[model samples]
Target: MKKLFTSYLDTFKGLSKEIWWLALITLVNRAGAMVIPFLSLYLRDDLGFSLSSVGWVMTCFGFGSLFGSWLGGILSDKLGYYKTILLSLIATGIGFLGLQFITSFWAVCLGFFALITVADMSRPAFFVALSAYSKPENKTRSLTLIRLAINLGFSAGPALGGIIIASIGYYGLFLADGITCILAGFLLIQTLNPKKAKEVDQEQLVENPLAPHKDGLYVIFLIALALFGVVFVQYFSTVPVYYKEVRLLTESQIGLLLGMNGLMIFVFEMPLIAYMERRGWNLIGNVIGGLLLTGLSFLFFYIEGWPGVLVLGMATATLGEMVAFPFGNAFALRRAKLGRQGAYMGLYSMSFSLAHIFGHNSGMQLVNSLGYNLTWAIMGLITLLALALLFYVKRRANTLKI
Candidate 1:
């Protein structure tokens, strides 16, 4: 028994110190991820935003995220990963402080847009840092490690956010969230210190955006990914709001239901992925299957007559999330040569960034106009279209030969 435990531990043993530090930073920052999970709810419950307005207002975050994704990649390459991470964190912390004071709708929307843009710049820079420290073969696992850290933190954030709002109000949550970001950035900077200064001050800095490579696999994947993202992202945006409105679940209940994704991922994903790889699981197959399951997950909302429909639906969605993301990151990086990782990671982040605009806005609009089940059914269909695209790309997956 002890040998088995030790062996499992060994699987995570060899990587870089940098990878571990990045995961630590992820844990600290994401532990305070109290804002976004509650953003839609805040708009609706506090400011009395109609569902349509909620959707449109959330569009600001998406637009900001799009620019943030681009900037994260670019700055990580040009200015260095450390500086990019530092600037993103400290700047976003200020944004959150600004958010605490906004009361009106347009003001709230603009605040969210600006805040998300600044905060999201951390994503690709974090990815670039991960790739720098990961061995080629372990890249997917490396990505999964940071994601695991994120999930572990998320497992706490929603539940904690629920408590904070109950005790201290949304204002407290925002201030807490802002403080953690600054703290995480500070800790990360101090830990890496002068050694991390290499990217900016040394030979590794990219002076120009590298041109896109041949065969356009990167571009194709990005387009297909955006489609899948439009479906996948509903868990964060539409799910809580829908359940709260229609199902009449309380904030704590909604948080737990949402946080279930985190708990399951934290416990199960690494071991499960390890087992699958040993059995020769195809990455693209997982991607396609995950997308299919994501669509199907929404169908549970139709089965409201059953007791566990919502929980079951969320369970299915979490599984889809687990399989898709790390593999997607891996696929994105698989085609890139050594130095261009920042560019690839940046563009990959952009896929979801763009999806946020389409998904949140269209999803809430559908909910307001067409109703939840119909909106979900439409999303399921879109997922199938995305699956078809992935299937096409899978056949030529090896063509990326970079």
Candidate 2:
């Protein structure tokens, strides 16, 4: 245990202050995501929203993010990463506070939209900062650490939210979450300021580095990644509804399940990425496998009555996420051409937004019309298609030498 602890510390030793600061920002921002883990329940139970209504609310949030991501990237390039990040944090914090005052469905939806927009806007800036910070050799590990921190925050956030929501309810959760965002923004303000790194010898060897690629590769990757976003969006939209409406789980139980996924991510993601890197597996293969694992895990919903099955499913899917996401990010960052890091990251962020808009709206419709079981089953099938797409993408990347 001590050895492992020391090794983990060693990983951070040479990491840039920018990576640490951004990651710390991620930690604080994600802590507020606890409110989101059970947002469907809050909408349905506390706000008296229907599934369709919840879908629209999520759609608004997604729509906001679509623009937010692009704007963040553009602004990062023009206004600087530090300014963009700080502005986004302020917007997101204000939005979270607005959530406390929502009484009607429209108000809630709008508030969510505003909050997600700001949070998402912060993403491109942070991504650009991270890419600018690390050496190619340590890049993957650095991202893994960032992810671990985010997951660690995620694990604790929902657990804390669960306890708070169970006792004081959603109002308290929203207020506390907002305050946390404010604190994060303040910390980031103190620590991070972007200063460009001079090109090193190793940077020259890497072809078409984040210098800005015009080959349209970024667009293609963005499209494929949006499909991934579609699959992931189910976590907030369909999964919560399923746990509640179909399986009859309580809020606390749902929180536990969501937190369990984060726990697995925190525990296993970095080591797994390291192991795969050691084996010389292509980054694309890890992404494909991750998508497959995530898709297949949905099959466990067939055993939802057992409760533990859901826990096991989270663990399985989380393992896939651990493997796929970090590698995919590293690959994408490395492939981005010079000076286009913000644009590429913005496109990447947009994929998640597109997915949320498409996935939630469609999943909610399917659930209302077809039923939760069938909806999940169909979603699994869609994920398989995404995996197949990843396969094609991998082959294409190899051919293009991207």
Candidate 3:
């Protein structure tokens, strides 16, 4: 037991203090990320919006994310990651604080679009910062550490968010979200000078970094990523509705269940990643396996009538997430040459943004028309398609020496 504990602890070693600081900032920001998980419920129950209406609003949210990601990439390259991140954090905080004032449907749609656009601008900049702060060899573990912080914060956020929502309503949730983001921004400004971080080795930099749009294989990889995101994001967008309506769970109960995903990742993911990294396993192959597990998670929903099946499905999906996301991020980062890291990471973030645009609205529309079982089935089929595309990417990457 002692040896086992030490081994688990060992996985966390060798990361720089800057990485830890970055992780801390992420933790603070994500811990207040209570709004999005409950956005659909708030729209439906509080504002009396229909499921389809909620879907449209969320689609607008996706469009905002798409634009923000592109802009962030450009800013990260032009202004540097530090300024880009700091600006995004402060702007996103102010946006969230003001968002609660817009109540009408169209106004709400516009509000969400504007808020998410500013908020997601942080994504690519954050990735570029991660690269700047960590050693080349430790990059994957560094990403895993940041992900752990995010999951840890997410695990706590939802549970507390449920309590906050129950006691003070959605306004309190928004207040918390805004305050935390601002606090994180201040924290970033106070600690960690970006100037002192490790510089990209000139010799290692690609002389001609391929533009992401022009890279066919990378585009294929992005499509697969977007599809995987479409399947995965259903947990956030539609699964809560399924929990409330079908399982008849309360807001608190739903929060706990959702929080379980982060808890599971926090407990297991780092160790698993360490083992995988040590083995030098193929990143794409691992992603393929993760996608398969994610697909099977949805298949469990087909059984129905038993709420435990929901738990099982969530577990399977979380395991798949743990396996796939960090490695996928590392793979993307590795593919980016130093000069154009911002563009590559931006497109990488955009794939998920694209997923957000189509995933939520489509899932909700399908559920409204076909019900949960069929929706899950369709998501599984989508995963299969994503997996097939990934196989092609793997082959092409080998052939192209990418």
Candidate 4:
């Protein structure tokens, strides 16, 4: 175990301060995100809210995220990433603290929206900073390191959050989240020591607004990603209610099952991404593979009384994510114009926001109307359609290559 741990530590030795800062921020940010896996539980079990109402809170959060990501991209260039990161963390900390004291539905809804804005706004800036930090050749590896750290935090967070909620309740969990966020903010502020107003302007003057590779195929890739986002976002939105109602899992069991995704991501994501990097296969193919795996995984819900089967399905789906996410981001960054990388990535980030709003609203309605099993089955079908679109994009990329 010591030897294994040493190897993990070795990977960090060569990275620059910028990369380390990004990874640390990811860990800190996601520790706050720990609440999400259990938020639905809190709403339903603690607050006596309906699933549909829970969906509305999620939608409002998504709406705030959409605005936040847009603003982050635009402002990160103007204000610098360090300021954006620090401000976002402070805002998120306050929001979490507010959540601890306020239980009213409207007020909680407002808090959710505010927190989501702060959280989402920080994401683009973090990515932008990391991309700036790494050299071109090492970009994918650096990004993967960040993903691994975030998932590592996520892997520990939900299970820990579950225990906290089960033991001290949401207040304890909320306070811990708030505290960690403030620490993360301070760490970011001290580490980055960002430039003043004029330095940001000088950097912008030299950066090309449109330089990443421009092609129609990239747009097609983004569209396929948007569709996949719909199903992906449902895990936090409706899957909890489905597991509780249809599968007869308790809150703790649901938390365990959700944590399984983070565990798989934490364990397998880097190696899987590394292998895919070597495969030299067009990423569009891997995207389809990811969609198909995700679709198939949902089908495991049909297995009667098999919570373990659901675990395998989620693990498989995460495997797909490990592949698809990095590839898609790399593809977008490579294809985007240099100066507008933030803009394109920001728009790409919007797809996730849109998906959350659509997924939560639609998943709740569909589950209520069509039953949990059917709702999942339909989500599978949406993935299949996304797979088909990706297939088309692959052919288009191939033709262009030829």
Report lDDT per candidate: 0.81, 0.78, 0.91, 0.75
lDDT of 1 by residue, 61-172 (tens): 8998999998898898898778899899899877887788998888988888889989989888888777677777677777888889999889899989988888878898
* Candidate 1: segments with Cα more than 4 A from true spot: 1-4, 194-210, 213-215, 398-402
Return the top candidate by TM-score: 3
TM-score of 3: 0.97
Write candidate 4's Cα lDDT for 1-402 as tens digits: 999776556544445667876788778877666677878778878888887788788788788888888788776778867788788888888778778777778887888887888878877777777767776656676777888888877777887887888888878778878888888888777777664111111123225565322545666676688789888877777877778887888777877777878778777776666666767777677778777777677777788865688787788778778878877777665554445656666776776787877877788888877888889889988898888888888888788772
Give the range of the ten consecutive residues with the poorest summed lDDT in model 2. 193-202
Ranking by TM-score: 3, 1, 2, 4
Q: Per-residue lDDT tens digits of candidate 3, residues 1-402?
A: 999999999999988888899999999999999998889999998889999999999999999999999999999999998999999999999999999888999999999999999899999999988987788888899999999999999999989989999999989888999999999999998875565555442336678778888877778989999999999999998999998998899999999999999999999999999999999888898898888898899887678677798889899999999999998998898888634999999999999999999999999999999999899889989998999999998888778766
TM-scores, in order shown?
Answer: 0.93, 0.92, 0.97, 0.90
Query: Which pairs of residues have clashing backbones in candidate 1?
Result: none
lDDT per residue for candidate 2 within 1-402, as digits (tens), equals 999887656545666666766788889888877777777778878988888998888788789888888888888778876788888887777777877887887777777777787878878887777766677787888888899889988888888888889899888887877888888888876776434333221454234444333546556666667777777778777887788877888888888888887888877776677777779888888888888887777888887458788888888778878877898888777765444678777877777889888888888889889987898778777886777677777888899776
CA error at residue 258 for candidate 1, angstroms: 1.0
**Cα miss at 104, model 4 (Å)?**
3.3
Best by lDDT: 3
